[model samples]
Target: MKSLMKTALAAAVFITASNAVDLKVLITDTLKNNQNLKADRYYQEAKQKSFQSVRNIYNPKLTGGLNYNRLDLDVRNTQVVNTAAAFVKFSMDLYDGGKNRALKNQKLYEYKAQKYQNISNVNQTILNVVTLYFNLKTIKENIEVYKEKGRALKAQYERIKSKYDLKMATQEDVLKLKSEYEANLYTIEELKYQKMQLIKNIELYSGVKVSRLDTSVIPDTNVKYSTTSDIKALEENLKASEESINIAKSSKKPQLKIEDTLSYYRYSDYNEKLLSDLPDKQNQLNISLTFNIFDTSTKSKVESSKYIKLATASRLEFAKKQAKTDFELARQKLLTQKEKIKSLQSAVDMANSVYNTVKIKYENGLVDNITYLDALSKKIYYIALYKQAQNELQIIKMEYYLKSGIDYKKLLSLLK
Candidate 1:
């Protein structure tokens, strides 16, 4: 009982560990190093500048100046235009109410929309990394498959050669098997080179030493792939677009602001200087309001916003229709691929059985070496065909999953 419990605990510990996935971890690492994400982060930080709306309040302007010339302390009848007077003027906004408020509100929504845009972009990046990783994995598996088949053919060819030397088989039979095995070997080499290229691509996307990393994740048959709900996604996108239109229109309304400033000024000569500690100092302050009432340009802006809103609505409807078509299309392709795989599997099994029978006949001296060699050739051909069918089916399945936005993490779990 104690031993059994310990074994169970060990199994549980292993199961609880996150599946060792080099590609997923590499993707996470790459996103951190992504220059685009870094730029988006900077954009997010810049959103803080919107707070200036509250502080840098636009105020009206003021003008003031003085001119003076001392009368000549000289001969009689000499007079100088000498006078000095200072005036303070102020202009303040009393009524163009709520325009600033609209501006600030629009900007707020714009910032939020940008945040969501970044989120959507990040999701796409994740998908891209995952798809590329799987493509490389598929090619790697092909290389292994070819290599294993090649080894089997090599063994069979050696057996045939020994039989031929013993005068039990024709030279033709021996040469044919040798040729097939050599072809398999050539295929293996080709696949190996292709696999090397895939590894290089993996390094390119991940920028990591994948040679030192864990194996990529593979899906198990036990897990299921769920199709995407296009209706739901389209609804969400439409809602976001609606918010965008609202943000655009918000720019048309009145806004609120408050601003205060302090500065020092110096002239060639001055009686009242802003920086001086003297009693008579010069400074000015005012408040103002701005309105965009008669601009014909805003009409164009409103039209564009309305058009975008309409366009989004239309696209959402079209997406619903397109989704239905795509779902059916994928369904048809999947069914076709499955049937093809099934037919090829059956053919391979029948050919294999026929080859075994021919082998028995040749051993009993009831059939020629040509018949036996032909059977084996046919069996091998069928096996290769079956493998190719499976590969094609796998690719189509992947496409279906991608199109439907199916999450395969549970599929990953089954591989363990």
Candidate 2:
């Protein structure tokens, strides 16, 4: 009987209806159309550009400008002089004590960290869509079960009423049927409310209307995992913090810079002849080396950077521990849910068998109406529990994948 119940429930829950929406397709659409994910993409692009912007800090800079000057001299001969010049300047950092290198590496690490963070967010969004989708499925199924029970109770109540009218049934039996029917109706109403809430949540995450879901995909429960995105992000942050320490220490070393300027000058005829000693075209190359001679803050800055690196290292370790803990917890939960479903499945089958027997006995006047009603109620209750456990087990499977850093959508794709 338990095996028969399992087969029947599996057929009922796993069979895909013609009009049902595929979860894999829904998740894909949600990822494409979700507004929050779009914003995250934009932010990640901005971070990538920032990393690119700092990559060429060692490249030379060239600039050109025009200048004009007018001078009046009344000291000796009251001479008036006018000059115009066009100059091009080229400058490059010959050496920066590895500051540019460290800065560039820091930006690269920051970009990588942000990229992993975005991946983490994507994982979360997929989980949200899947969870809501499954929750709606469970609530809808439960509502239908309650409605079926309600219909059955209503029919029973009407039959008892007819018997009462014929003076073949007691008033107590009729009243019990009516009361049970009303309670069944109240349960249906409550389940409908839960279904409505689940629908709204599903729409919020998937950005689509809720309807029938295709529950054909059954993911494997054997958990497989890699380093999670959260851990990767934290590792990148640690690297960035180390680079910051490098950048801070670089300030204590000497820096060398080189510059070259070329100028073409034009002057008034009188001034040109009077200042013939200066050439019409001039070129100059300059090199300078400088260091922080007496700054008290450099040591403090480096020490601060070191502390930050230590903090980031600590965070990375904590994240690793937390990820492991979460995965183990999810695994335990999945195991427990499986056991619960096993137990409830047998209970549902037994309750159903008892209800069928008691229903026949009651109709033949061999059993009390109270015994029949209790059997009916127990059957429905066990069926609801069994169905809910099955749906929740699916959620646990997905969460197991999430904790292991396995992509749940890819698992869904295996349904094909």
Candidate 3:
């Protein structure tokens, strides 16, 4: 049944849009279009019905029938007389090994587990959607970065051509600038394609078209610059997993149940009456108990659940170790990007100084355009490198938030 629903959802959202829409709008539409959400809701509702399914008082049944006695003896002028009876009987289950009660508990726990599972699913879906959103955001920023570089290079290319016309600049410089401009254009095009692919992923998952995006902001979840935030969340997850193991273990014990029954009946006779006893309004009562001493097949499930719980604990431990490593790596990477930014910032300033001074020299015919253009190009490149350095810093810090469990809404709030 679930596989069929998933297939339906797949067919519904299979097509990608011709163009992208706004991310938030797309999310809203996707939720509306999401057949999977509806399926989850239906399953949850079915689980809720289990509450109403708790064993209830079943009413006793009353039976009625008619019959004729055959006696050809010449009695009562050989008359044909009618005979009828109205009787009530009570029935109850003696004991089915406490299976009903156990079933009820199983259903209850299953319902609860499903609720938690749904919460986890929502969290994961939000993560995927937000990741795609930010992925597009990153690509868009890179596109702008390249566009800025292209602008600078285009201007330099024209200046070099002018210098070449004056026989003051080599063809090599002009060709280099042209090649750089083309490369920047190509980079921009690639970034645009990447951004669209991110949008395509969002559409496939959310089942909505993405039209526009608010890229003026970025996520800045202020993670407690602590040493053990990820560890803390992992610990919580482990505890929950442990409790789940307990729930599964609870299933192995034999179940016990108690039951009772009661009822009444009415009667009448054809031609008033011909019976040994009248329909005697009767009452009934009963009690039952049962136990299952052996089921080798079920033991496997208990063991499997236990092993999964234990594995979760082990995974948490591994994550703790990985977090420590990431902490050190983040520290090193951020420091490197920072030092590089500082170095290149100074370089840009010095290059700008040189370009200005040399521009003065060129105007005075003391030097040529080639020298001035080279200095200008160096300054622009340094500025571009500085932009990359900033992005690298943000990436480093983003790790801190992600490790701290910065979810979509929280991340969105930070971006806002």
Candidate 4:
């Protein structure tokens, strides 16, 4: 007996601990460990580095290498010569017709676009976590409702079976109650299976095992709107496209460059003696400007970039309109769920009253087993509906917040 009691105590403690988990904490952990988010962050960093790489055009580039050459003369009195040279070259682009500046801006805007895209991905991950968490919560509550109904049916079945043995109740009555009780148990099992599936899904998103979910509290339904990452990302893309036009135009202008080279040369004859008359060390500098006199490709590239910018601008406008539409729809859903929850609560109450009345009439032999069973079924159906509406209200509220561009953490704080 002591061992059994200890086991029960431990099981209760475990359940309580699991139920104590906060949804916000799970979301935080998920955001921290999500592989997709990590990949996006790395990609954003790479874009940032790419932008930095092209930001400075005046920086000088230095390179050094060694070269070896051997010449064999076929003519008379011509000796074989071997030459080895070590050379260092320094080069700088004095001007690129604003090409490098435009390139830098393009990279910078591309990085910004990626940065906002990462933010959007984070929001999506949070929504996934929240959705799964609430789904588990709803399933858990439904399981409890089924368990309660199962217990009530179990007692009613036992009572009917006793009455049948005494010939006071018909065999059909006993069989019907037994069937209902068994069905209730099956439903509970099915719900438990669904709960298990939901838990696994939560783990898939959060990278943490979920034994239970804490959703006794619901988030506030108040919604607010602000700029969303999706729109920001598109705006950056449009800016980058505008910069591409400048980059293309720069290609049509003059490009100037400066280069200097210092070299040490070693000359040797067939006998390997140094040729003293030949110059050994030399320095050379060159400054040149070049222009693409007339290029059909430059005009085509400029036109393509302008078209890209126009396309992006159209997409951005569509995104803004879509966001507005979604937000309004989410608000409508939230309000509908609120009304449904209120109506279902009243329905559950009425159904429970009707069930109590029918149950009393059946116990007194005033009503048939079918009526009693029907009332019980109606009561549980209403209860399930009420619970489902309550859960859906929370989900709708989250949807509303998401459309409003409110951060999930802020929404979590609003949860009572």
Candidate 5:
């Protein structure tokens, strides 16, 4: 029997050790496989391609074509004529009133903005995963507390039942103990359901089935807020919007382009004599200048672009303020949760001492069953509360880290 028990205990220990996952590994896996982050990366790549396309807007273009014509004339005499022509044209925009440059700048800023946006998405996803992971740990700890309470209540109920059989304890006492045990059992079941849901949510986000999560990781509480990706992305967008305004303004300026064409023609008919004056080969070069001097549409577009720039500027300001506000709030919550945890720790210690004293007295027949049960329940409640506070404190720390723009990888590295 002892050998079997030892083997079972060893197996349980081994399973627990094997299931334990580091917080850093969990976060790294989440970043690698998260669908939303992958989508954002793809979007960033597309924006980069668009930026490159914009830079090549002024590349030279070459075009070639062939044409055939046939004619029969009966005016002076019967004549049959056929013509075949081939032409090659090369064209390039030498100047576009600086519009192309502004467009390229806009796309460049947009691409940068997308890169920062991806970073922001990653940060948010990390926050969600960390929060959910810790929440599951908290719920599981609470379940254990309830289970312990249930066990204590069950032992007390058995003792009371034995006393009632000897007419030493009342039936009411036995029923009360039984009721508390049942209630604790119900609470455990509810908590287990909650844990199941949390596990599912974590699996959905991290793309892995997590059997155990390490809660020993701690974050630096002294971290301070700084510029985050959200603010940077908005700043880039503002620059892009400003470039749009410049592009619109440039549309009113003159456009200059150069074109060169080479042509060859062949004629094989009776009308060749009449068409002998036509050149068999020709080359032409042309320079064109176009200016929209009286177009109301260009003016309207310029005004619209300016308005959009203003809006973008407003959004940037708002983002900065929001980031600051979030950081302050998270820091404040962290401080509050820290204090709460300290107080709950003290309470738990006191509750444990009282429960131990009451249990000894009840065993010596110096205290009633109800008193012993109350002491045990108090200990369990305080313990559960303390664990919950600790979990909440960790969550707030994570929020503070995220809001402060601290690198999550660095934060995870601090885990020990």
Candidate 6:
């Protein structure tokens, strides 16, 4: 009997290993096909383009205009004059109290912040996929446990029915067994439905249909916490806000700019004869410095920006604290799950021993059907508990890895 049990265990292990799916492949596919991630990629591209646009603040701008005029005088009501002129102008910011440079830096920092945010989004989506995959895997395993219990109940029911026919058991015993069997069937059906829903959720997030998942993938539970993408993104945001303060402060300084224009003029012979000394063509270069001696709004804007910078700093501090709290919580939960798994494994062993003893006594007619059935139910319940605890341990480990910001590829490499 021990040899047979060992053979069965070995076969189950072989089946599990044979059917194992590569977690790396699944994660890669999820990253490629997830709609939210694709949308975030487009958003990141937009931010990049905005950064490029901001960097062109010093580029020269060209503008052109044309004008036509008609003039009449009461003293010369019968006479009319027409004039036309056109001009092309070019202007660029020679300096704006460094506001342009600060604004450009702010956009660049914002783009960096956006990139980190995208990374955070990707990580969160991957975490969700991993969670759903494992949940489905656990539910599938639970269904098998329920089926095993059903088989045991069916066997017991048949034994009781046979005993009733032989006048050794009462109708009550047969009826009780039948009811338990039906209940087990109902439970199995419910579990199957739950498994289907999990599969649907996984498909929605990953854009891939999942029929099976391997629970053999283990992650390092001893990893230390590192800077998560959230924290980095917040840091960038704070820097960007600081740059904005500089931009606002720059508004209070003098602005120096250069303007250049070239123009052409034409007049009818009648108008030219009336105004003889008018120049027909012109070119001009002007350099101007303007200072805001007492702008009422600049002070208010700078104060508002300083307050925003303060708020951003506060948020950064809060985020750091929250990340640390999450890391510690996940770590503690992992430890607690490990302990639960150990205790439940011992309970499973004891329950199996009791079930085997009850089965022997029932076969020898030393115990009643109800007592035997109860022992068997206890054994099945403990087995399910052990399996659930094992699954929870894996999930907690994954959570720890995520909180620690460990590379998912490294976690995937640990799969056996």
Q: What is the model-wide C-alpha lDDT for candidate 5?
A: 0.85
Per-residue alpha-carbon lDDT of model 6 for 286-391, expressed as tens digits?
9999998887888888888889889989999999999999999998998898888889889999999999999999878899878988998888888888887777
By lDDT, who's the top model here? 5
| 256-291: candidate 1 lDDT, tens digit per residue | 333333333323233333424532334445454444
lDDT of 2 by residue, 196-308 (tens): 89887777767887677776445675656679999999999999999998898888899999999999987663443455566688999999999888889989999999999
Mark the regions of model 6 whose C-alpha exceeds 4 Å error after superposition. 1-21, 57-59, 65-86, 266-270, 275-280, 408-416
Query: Which portions of model 4 miss their true places by more than 4 Å?
Result: 1-15, 74-80, 215-218, 221-223, 270-276, 407-416
Residue ranges of candidate 2 with Cα displaced over 4 Å: 1-18, 57-59, 70-83, 170-175, 266-273, 276-279, 365-369, 407-412
* Local distance difference test, each candidate: 0.59, 0.84, 0.60, 0.84, 0.85, 0.82
Error of 5 at 183 (Å): 1.8
Query: Is candidate 2 or 5 superior in lDDT?
Result: 5
Compared with the true structure, the alpha-carbon lDDT of candidate 4 equals 0.84
Q: By TM-score, highest first, what's the ranking?
A: 4, 5, 6, 2, 1, 3
**TM-score of predicted model 2?**
0.87
Which is the better candidate, 2 or 4, if ranked by TM-score? Answer: 4
The deviation in Å at residue 224 for candidate 2 is 3.7
Question: Which model is ahead, 2 or 6, in terms of lDDT?
Answer: 2
Name every residue pair that clashes in candidate 4: none
Cα-based TM-score, every candidate: 0.59, 0.87, 0.55, 0.90, 0.89, 0.87
Worst 10 residues of 3 by lDDT: 262-271
**Which pairs of residues clash in candidate 6, taking residues 3 or more apart in a chain or in different chains?**
none
